[model samples]
Target: MNGNQKTEPTINRKTARELELIQFKSGYEDGTIIAQQQHMNSVLGAISFAFFLALFSAGPDAFSKPALIVSEISFSASLVSNILLFFFYKTVSGKKDLEYIWDFEQTSYAEIFKTIALFAPIIGTFSLIFHYSTLAFIFSAFIAVVGFATFLLAKNQISLRDSLLSEYRLSLLYAGRDEDYFTLKKHEFKQKPSAEELKINKYDYSICNQKKELIGVVTLHHQAVVGDIIEIADSEPLTVLRIIHNERATKLICKEYTEDTSAID
Candidate 1:
């Protein structure tokens, strides 16, 4: 037995379809969330740019120097973060094919820029409003703390949901063979079973020639009946000659069907 040739659990056609549907739904939801976040970032970028322009036009005397500088820096940071995130989303989304879902959580750049973009505007606005009075500034700081805590809570919830969905999709991917169906076709002939002692299971099949010469064993999940033509591993197409059933299991007797073999048959 080949050490690498491990058998996979068989999934019926109906169960496979169900797994496929579940995978599709999970991908769709993930894509939707990504799109929503992209849209939110775009909107926030525009708002931050507008505020930056307004502050710049207000001149040095319109607000205290410290307040003015901090506000300008905050808005600029938010704007830059949003722009970087926008391009990141575009580049990542464009490179990926439509076959797989976008996993945003996998990229730390995305999370960092998104968080900065989301909260920078709030910080800038509060700093500008409460700049003049110490008491007002302290109150604004308390409110900002509460808001930041709320945002963290919401972010945690979203992360938890994404983690669960990712795990579920991974389980479904492993449970079904759809992802590796074509890869299985390239399996090499491993072991040949003896004619006197043949074994038939869900994944392993024994093939023999008409004279009971043991050919090679192939892994097949479906039942092989007489007259069914199947290409075993790297061999030519072989026609099933007969099926022998004993108390244990059934054995397949096959022969290569070529022009010469056809004439002989």
Candidate 2:
């Protein structure tokens, strides 16, 4: 034995599965944000076209001095909102590093577009009321649909922002550690099974097992020693299958192993 076994391993099958699920959830949120941003671009395009169509359809009589001022103000606001949406789409569509993404999320200007987009229908309805047009309700309803779409886009972006922030915090845990862990270039296997032993450093782990092979990565919250086997909270026993060391961090590759085994046949 490498050392006296004291405690059990903390990572097991169930906790590994939960970590995988968390990664999937974060990925889904990111995809939803991108899809919604694209959809907003298309929706805003249609809304812009309709805005101009309604303004022109009103004809010369539609713009008395007072009416003209109201239309100009509302249309200008809508135009500015469209410009903001365009920039937002550009940022999301282009390839961005983590810093750029963080910066974009921090800006308050994007919220202005969201607010304008959400309230556009109200402005359109007001304009129609002044014109006394026959299709006033229809135009107002169309703008309302666009506004609601914008609302959904904004909500998804908020979710994505939160998830990215969470991911960034996780990344920081390994961002600056450069000399703590060393990578294993080769692994040795024994002709027959031997006692299990695990060596844990600050960020790296070395598992000693005669009949062992490379397996997938696992996470743990607590520490363990050579002969000690630990279990995650309410999970099965964690049997260390292998170990992987990289510059970013050390991963314990594990699987359940209860019986002694010979080397590869």
User: Best by lDDT, which number?
Assistant: 1
The CA root-mean-square deviation of candidate 1, after full C-alpha superposition on the true structure, stands at 19.1
Question: Superposing all C-alpha atoms, what RMSD in Å does each candidate have to the true structure?
Answer: 19.1, 18.9
Q: Given candidate 2, what's the lDDT at residue 124?
A: 56
In candidate 2, what are the lDDT values of residues 86-182, reduced to their tens digit?
A: 5656565544442354355457975666677656645754765656654775677678789999999999998998788656555655675332222
Q: Could you tell me how far off, in angstroms, the CA of residue 248 lies in candidate 1 after the best superposition?
A: 40
- Local distance difference test scores for all models: 0.72, 0.55
Question: What is the lDDT, from 0 to 100, of the residue 82 in candidate 2?
Answer: 62
Candidate 1 CA-lDDT value: 0.72
Q: Which candidate should be chosen as best, given TM-score against the real structure?
A: 1
Tell me how far the alpha carbon of residue 119 in candidate 2 is from the true structure, in angstroms, after superposition: 2.7
Candidate 2 to truth, TM: 0.39
| Candidate 2 Cα errors over 4 Å, as ranges | 1-35, 65-73, 91-98, 101-114, 133-210, 214-243, 247-265
